[model samples]
Target: MKRSLQITLLVVVAALGLAAGLAWQAWRDQPATVPDATGTPGSDARSTITSLVVGKRRPDYQLPDLEGQARSAAAYDGKVVMVNFWATWCPPCVREMPALEELYETYRDRGLVVVGIALDNGEAVVDFVDPMGIEYPILIGEDDGIDISRDYGNRLGVLPYTVIIGRDGIIRHAHPGEIDLEQARAYVEPLL
Candidate 1:
């Protein structure tokens, strides 16, 4: 009986050891997860940024605003333009709206045009934009905005993606996440 008990204990220990080994192996095989401001799990920091390379001509596309007025990259050509792709639902996106507004207010008259593309449905974007008093042209694309963003180099569909286009019509920088006032100054001051 004692021999049988010893053999059962050995089997249990082996099974536990095998399970641990498998778990470790699985963990090792998984890509590293970086914490974002949204606290989403399994979010890859690298994949969040698309089209990191600068000096490429930005793809041109036309989208309508909440008022149904057409806006396009070409319309703002020969000006230092900052095209920001954002969604109303994204916390980080909402957080940076004021900073963007400030940036636009400060430089709009100086040949800097800041365009906000809102990726939201129906009147949701209008409702959000109205109270915020966003001065720059805001184009509404809804879900189709995802494809537009991908075309602009936001392959991961990340919110709060910004691309700076020099007056020469070349992309100077494409970045993901919220832009602080200082970063905004740095990006636009040189182009201005």
Candidate 2:
């Protein structure tokens, strides 16, 4: 009788585990629900960082690209621009790079431009970007990135910070962390 009871308990546990695994698999296969530019249910859509910079004309800066080319924010005045501040050492920054590249390519011909401000050395930025096949204009910020980030409204000086400027040169969004592709699209699509 003891052996029979033990077998029954094992069978019950196995069944429960199988049921949980199946449920998890089903949930994993479900599509992710993308939130719109407005607030999603149970969450405020407005970001404090964006609130600080939005509606203000983006500050101009001239930073050097990888090949010693001077790229100025002022030069992109008539185009919608995304300026992303990132470091090669930051994991979240690395993870979201591909998404940024894709977003840039998708909207480049539609009046949207994406620029990456790498807070790392030019050599390191080149090494990191080359492996990832990053094709956007990358500015080497080095140590001056802290001050530049502050000018862009990133008071805390977070990595992977992003600022979106509309075609009229007004800041639209300032985000301080990694952003998914869908969320980025939502922010840029309406302007295009």
TM-score computed on alpha carbons, candidate 1: 0.75
lDDT of 2 by residue, 1-192 (tens): 999999999999999999999999999999976333222322222365666788998888888898979888998989989998999999989988999999988989998989999999999998888878888889998888767877888766667788889999999877777777997898899898
lDDT of 1: 0.81
TM-score of 2: 0.75
RMSD score of candidate 2 (Å): 11.1
Residue lDDT tens for model 1, 2-78: 99999999999999999999999999999965335231323454344433436788888888888988877899999
TM per candidate comes to 0.75, 0.75
**Model 1: colliding residue pairs:** none
Score residue 55 of candidate 2 by CA lDDT.
90
